[model samples]
Target: MSQVRTKVILYNPKAVFYTMPLALIALASYLDKGIYDVKIIDGRLEKDPLMKILDSCEGAVCFAVSVLTGAPIKDALEMTIEVKKRFPELNIVWGGWHPSLFPLETLKETPVDVVVRGQGEIAFEQILTAIINGQSFQGIAGVSYKDKVTGEIVQNAERNMVDINSFPAFNYDFVPVNSYEKLSGRNQIDYIASQGCRFRCNFCADPFMYKRGWYGYAPTRIADELETLWDKYHFEHVHFQDETFFTIGARVEAIAEEFIKRKFRFSWFGTMRADQGSRLPDEVFAKCKASGLERVMIGLESGSQRMIDWMKKDIKIPQVYESAQKCLKHGIAINFSVIIGFPGETEADMDETIRVVTDLRKMSPEFRVSIFYFKPYPGNEIADALIADGYKMPQGIKEWSDFDYVVKGSPWIPEKKFREIENFKFFQRLAWSKPSLLKTPIQTLAKWRIKNKSYHLPIERKLIELIFDRQKLS
Candidate 1:
């Protein structure tokens, strides 16, 4: 007779993007299938996600949720609260960036019984084993939990990052690939070929989270998994969500060769640093483009060399131009993201950034420029400095929910500067956008306005806003 297997429910909270919850899938795929029955319910995909979650909680060993740092926290909190109310004995676990950053704070304030800090596959498996044996979670590395008897949160020693190749590839069977395809309106698969970033950009949290370490699956392994997944899903594109896809030029070349040799019929997108792109050989770029490389995102944070150094971006201004030329030559679409409004940044600094953005925009119609205001996120050198100087972070989850990257306005930016940036962002979009039959005249006017630095008496902006508002109402 077979023994009864324990049930585990993994949930993904609602968020702005429709990307697949690979973190939950990774954990689910790593668990022992013989002793556990796992159920994954994504809030974004469900109409009655709360009902589904509560239903799945019954007879489950634990209900786990993967969380991010911003708006998703609000929904995750609401769902977890209801689960805790109905099934008080069920272990509610939280993992992902937010919990990994503030494990003790999460355990103390929220209903989460355990917080899995970093590199959760091995640690999470150990956690489940402890739960099944009714044993203490005293020695589970990378875990923080409240002692059931003592009622004190016990923080475990940090877990060493393990080689991802040691684990099984993600099982896309955990979620409906078609649903994501429909949601994103693209025949694309979101994949992560690596974990952690080796960069130490002061404004980025990656360095703290990954400790300036990086690891990737073997090229053969990545190609093998992608081919298998393609055979199953038939996706036309693979969006590699790696932080730095071209970190190792040799590995990138090998991966491209593998894809070419396998005759994979899918285009791919990934990210690169300006320095990395500038250093890549023309032959490697040719190999990648031949392997269906459609686009690459390069983070050109600032045009001002002084500001770039201050941010520790480590890429010179000339490197940005070189990277752009290389991508343009390869006929690859490039999205260059720029950030303004850093603390202590002057008007001159902002002007320099705009200058670079404008120059890059002129490089090619295939090149795209995205402008954003800097938001201070914790666990980064900049945020730590601000905190050290008495810049209070959000007190709880409610405050943190407001920390969104896409939102306009930053505390450091004055109202006048903020409005100017907002106006420039709008006009910049119109100035460089592909000319539509109906909007060519407006695009021409936008280009003239940008060239002349004439934003005052912005009738076009007013009219556009009115039309948008009317459309929303209609």
Candidate 2:
């Protein structure tokens, strides 16, 4: 009697614990009849046991192995190599944003036997079915793999998943709810009511990914999925994984109105463009909050006029403050992500940023500020220009790799100076301003420890040590 071979897959690396990549694969599992005994390893809960991941499965797939987001690709590749080292006959694959952008480079650098780029819902299922039948991946759509016989790069045209409803709701059964709850500050899981984005921000690939088109799910369908999650899992919160959640206000209004009608006041959060906040007044925010829009993340690329124009962000500094003020007044908790360095920023530019963070803090003590280094993603105007001009990304000396690795293109500010601006001193000025409650730094990490005990201990220690060391030297 022949033994049945089980299919195993592993996913790792998430920016937010609100959503899981394994959920997408599990959706594929629903279409499957369990003929192959499918299994999943969620890296978000904790790092997966690599040897076990390799030894346990006949075939497997990983996500995001190409761009800056996949900066630690060498580590990801090494894992696959280890798997192949142990099981010479095992099949390995890669997927997500990194693969979608640089499939060719990924094939060369990693032991990724195959890659599924873009939306891999149907494509993933097809790959498993084909491998089970002992077929080659020559004709798989949205997949790229080596042509062993031809010794050439073989890639299929990108296939975008338009019917998001066709995909099953994100499942938490595979991942412990406690683990996710601990990381994301909510007990509920999330789903994509929409896919792709329409904005043409030069630094982001959303517009590039969808050919500048945005796709959304039906309101009824979305409501049905959320209702199922609430009804079945007894979940009381949700996170919508939409790039610009209120891109079409009507869709959002419809969803919010449905919640009001059903009395489903579930806590939820979503990302949105900053300018839109000005248009949505206090009444709209009250409605959203009542229906459960607890938090919103807005990206303020920079406070400097010159820096803002260079990135072609379209939105201006005044708009940022206005939008921020509106959100604050409305009682809608705001989580801001600010970009510090960009092309041609001066001391004045950095100071302007200090001013913005200072004012925003005055509005509320509960407001959260997330500071990030500027990055030039692929297919972006800035990235293309930089690569054309022989720009080198700087990895921080003390802090190792992070979003800070990408040195901004500003000619006036050296990478070190930019790092200094982001360091502890910049934050101390603002934090020391108010003696009440012992203010945390406006810059987040003052080259020193940030006040948020929620942050990792190592990061906190390093930041504190770095800032203190710098202070002692001064």
TM-score, each model? 0.96, 0.79
What is the C-alpha lDDT profile of model 1 across 358-436, one tens digit per residue?
Answer: 8888787678888888888777899889888898888777788677877687777789877777777787776676666
Model 2 steric clash pairs: 344-410, 423-446, 423-447, 424-446, 424-447, 448-463, 449-464
lDDT of each: 0.89, 0.62
Q: Which segments of model 2 are wrong by more than 4 Å?
A: 1-6, 13-19, 22-30, 34-36, 46-48, 58-68, 183-185, 393-412, 415-420, 423-474
**Model 1, stretches more than 4 Å misplaced?**
436-438, 465-474
lDDT comparing candidate 1 with the true structure? 0.89
Q: What's the lDDT for residue 427 in model 1?
A: 79
**TM-score of model number 1:** 0.96
lDDT (Cα, 0-100) at 417 in candidate 1: 74
RMSD in angstroms between candidate 1 and the native structure over all alpha carbons: 2.3
Clashes of each: 0, 7
275, model 2: CA deviation in Å?
2.0
Q: Write the per-residue lDDT of candidate 2 for residues 185-239, one digit (tens) a residue.
A: 6667666677777777777776655666667877777777688767766666787
